[model samples]
Structure formats: C-alpha cells, structure tokens
Target: MSRLDVTTSVPVFTRPLRSTCRGVPASEAPPLSSAASLVGQQVGHFRLLRELGRGSLGVVLLAEHALIQKRVAIQVLHAHVTQDPARVARFLQAARTLTLIQDAHIVSLYDLGMRDGRPFLIMEYLEGQSLAAFAKGPLAPALVVDLLTQVCDALGAAHAHGIAHGSLNPTSIFLVPDAKGRQHVKLLDFGIAGLLPPSEGAADSPVAADLFAVGVLGALLVTGRLPSRGHAAEEPLHGHAWEVPPLPSDLRSALSRVLLKAMARRPVDRYASAAGLRDALHASVALDGGAAPPESLGLERLPGWYALRGPPGVAPASR
Candidate 1:
C-alpha cells in the first residue's frame, strides 16, 4: 500500500508501491486512507477543504474548484475498497448512472475522475441537511405531500432511464431551500445500494425495492417513525399479514389508503411506478380540501427548517 506523506500541510502520495498479489500491478493496489489525510490535497481540479461526512463506501469532502473556485462536494472511494474489482466497477458505474439521470430533484453530478487509482465524484454542494434531520417528528400533511412529490418526480425520471435508485433512506433524501426560500428535495446516492453485494431474499427487482422504500419513507413522514414489523392478527387489504401503524386522527381516510397500498408486502399490490405513487399521493391530499401550494410552505415560517442554513445573516449556497 502507498502511504500519503503528511509531513507537510498537504498530503502527497508516494510512488513505487508493492503489488497486492502475484501478477497484480502496483497501481491497482489500494492506497492509504483517502479521507482526512487528503484534506488539503488536490483531487482532479478540486482542492479538498474539509471532510463533510463519511459513509460505508466513501468519504464526502467539501472542496473548491481550483480555477473556477466553485464549491462542490466530492465523494472519494476508500482506497482499501478498491482491492475488489467488482466494487471498483460498481463505484464507476454509479458515476455513470448519475450522469445519465438529470432532474431538479436529483443531486447533479458535475464531474468524475480517477485520483491515484481511486474514483472520485464531484457533485453539487448542498447547504441543507438530509430529510432525516427534520423528520424527527410528524410533519404537516401538506408539507409531506409537497416534499415527497418532488422525490417521486426524481425517482420517476430515473426509472424512465432504466435506472432504479435502489436506495431511498431518509439520509439519502436531502432538503435544501430554493432561491425563494422554499424547501426543495434533492435525492442523493442514486444507484449506490445496488453497488453493494446483494443480501439474501432481497426484493425481486430494483424497481420493486425502490417502491418499497418509498412506502417506508411515506410512513416515516406521516408518523415520524418506521412501521412496526410483525404479523397482524388480521390480514391487510393487500392479503399480507403485516402491521400497519395507525395514522394521526386528523389524517383523512383517503391518504390512509394510499399509505397502505404503497406499503403493501407484495410488490404487485403497490403502486406500479413512482409516478403512480406520486399521483395517488396528490389525489389523496386533494380529496381532503387541497395541498398547500409550494410558495405558501416557505421555510422561514417553519421551525428548524433553517437550521442547516446557519445563523440569520448567512445565505444558502447556490445549487
């Protein structure tokens, strides 16, 4: 393994590394830690400023373009993980997948390149936190519909391109403010979960799995927690024996039905596509008066919505 020379402020990569195994080239071997050590180093044209966060697959860094000076988020694959050819291929495939899908609700991929034999992705830098932060408690029904509709649109666009997000957890669902200070949804880590080795008895297909996750997200938004997993005494309308959490008393029956269908144990019973799920959500909300318009749901009026934007005088970065 090649170690990064950290004697100075910026770490520099050392050359002439040993081969991982017989016949494997030195360049193909995994390098040293690529996260904190590379803070002041240059990856492609971007200069890493600080570490944003770390995940199972890679480290996300806050970086700035050398020439243009534009701020961006860079996801650098852990050098150790590159030992597996399959994982490396999947990581590159994820970058290609992001480049193929373009939607306002999906995080934009600015560039992709190799740094010291490791793959890195340059993406739009978001100033807001993930949906998980704000979803600690039940959100307003109107707000939920508004936010999720954007998510559905993003997923629908990906599905059209023959790509499934496969991963739709709250952490991957980010919430940023638009120019007008309205909450906006930006789905992150598209096609990432598929990059991992498949688990036993996973969903039959990626599309089905994505829809199931959407249902789980819906339940979380409505109840501020995941639905309990257990056999219900009575079978659900979809003929599945699973427990469904009771919605708030104020919620209308139409929305309740929508939740049930989206969360059906059998994929055949769930919404056929993300668009279908989105339409059902809109229709359900419409039946009970109408959902509030986007402009009306400004983040300024909502508590904790501006938490990620920093203190009062700070303006959010442009997307």
Candidate 2:
C-alpha cells in the first residue's frame, strides 16, 4: 500500500516564529528563570500544578483556582517569544477571542494575565484525546456525522462573531468525556486562529476555508488519511479517491457527496456556512438511525496523552 500522504500546516501564530523557533531549539533557549518556575506557585488565584503539554510556542499547565479549587489549563508563552511586540499582540488576541466566543463545543477562556513579561491564559482543562488519536482508524458513520455536526455548530458560532479558526486539524479537535462517560467534542487552540486572508475568489473567504478544513477532517475520520495534498486542479474535480476500508453500500453515496462537497477546491463550490454544512450532516445521519453520541458509544479506548495521568486533578480512565 502506498504510504498515505497527509498535508499539514503550522498554526498561523507559529508561522512568524518559524525561523527564530527553528534557530533556537528548546534546548538552546535559556532555561526558565527561578521566577518562571510556576509549579506549586500561584499566579493570581490559580495554583500551577504541573505541565501538560509543551511546544516551541508555549507550555500548557494544569492549574487549580486557589479560592474555588476549580481546575483549568494555562498556556504560558515561552520567555524568549515574549520579546516580539507583534507576536505578543496576536497571542493576546487569540486568548481574547476565546473569551469572547462562548460555545459548548469550544474551549472556554477563563482569564488572562501577565507574568514576568510573559502572558498566560487560563482555559478549560479537558480530560480526553484529540481527534488525532483516531486519525489512523475508520470511525463509525454515526460518530463521524456527530463530530461533524458539533464542529460545524462551533464554527458557525465563531464565524457569526467574526472569528475564524484559521487552523483546524485532528490535534486541535478534542474528544472530551463527561461524567457519564459519553464523549463530547470541543475545539481547542483558537488563540492563534484568525480570519482568512482575502483572495481573488470565494475560496479565499474565511468560512470557505473553515468548511474546507471540516471536509478534510471528515475525510480523515472516514478514510484514516487526508485527501491527497494538491490543488483541486491536480485531483478529480469532485473528490479524491479514498483508500480505506469500504463503507456499507447503503450510506456510501451520501457520505461521499458530503465529503466531496465540503472539501470542494473552490470556496464557491463548498457549503456557504458552517450551519449549512451541519444541516447536510444531519441529513446524512438521518439515513441510518444516527450514530450514538460520541460519549455514549464505547470507542476503542484512546491511547497516548488521554491515558496518561496528570497532577492531582481529573485523570482520564481507559474504557
């Protein structure tokens, strides 16, 4: 089998720092100063517990509110990256947008603050796996539509408010479980997602770009591989040929149509709005009694980060 080729793009916020970030590897970057040693320390009312995720851009930490004992995730910019005024403005805007946009499917920003010349955002901490965890496997048809519907709802809400999640990928789409074990979908990393740049055609519209991303995400869920990386002109006008386990004949046509249209190369050919795409997803779900909500269905247990234990907060258990 040909190794499936998947196209990936860096988050818009990180693109500007590519040269500098690449030049100064994490090891070469100066160590966190004593004042920057946040663990077991309090920032405002939140007590930093331990690190959750770290990257060139920032570090995500698990923190607890001192007064309420509520837990949240806090992302602190790397010390060196804080020197760039433009980058800092964009970073702060990212957090502001999250705080402004309210949706159950989107991660919520609780607060923002400056610490030792660096900025940090307090956000809802999730106990689950990113969709990236499932990128290699075929998902039940119902679950695909469910994730699609919820994500569309989230995109639509953000679009309505003039925010565009410039970056949408498996890693940013999280599958969070509720107390009852039913998994709910939530979007993360909106801080760097900004409006799309204007282009010659409708395809350049932010909404179109978002829908295109959704189409790609759907393709990943069903086929376990991204649509071939190339311009629409390079592939078939409708949809790229998918190489994955075949689906039931009963719903294959509808599924194919949705994927192709959502991923249409030209923005004009794609769904006009996230809500429109969601409605189409609902129509598809109607074909089969609909897949159980992600939370209700017992998906193969998520591995990696989802199974790892964090500090003394909510730990995700394998099913």
Leading candidate by TM-score: 1
Please give, for residues 271-305, the per-residue lDDT of candidate 2 as tens digits: 88888888888887656455455455534333221
Model 1 lDDT tens row, 10-120: 111111112211122334323426576778876655677997766566777777767878666666777776777776777677666666665777754565566566776
* The candidate that achieves the highest lDDT relative to the unseen native structure: 1
RMSD of 2: 11.2
Show where candidate 2 strays beyond 4 Å. 1-36, 194-203, 226-251, 288-319
Question: Number of backbone collisions per candidate, in order?
Answer: 0, 3
In the order shown, what is each candidate's alpha-carbon RMSD?
10.6, 11.2
Looking at model 2, residue 88 earns an lDDT score of 78
Pairs of residues at least 3 apart in sequence or in different chains that clash in candidate 2: 94-191, 182-295, 183-295
Please estimate how well model 1 matches the true structure, expressed as its whole-model Cα lDDT.
0.59
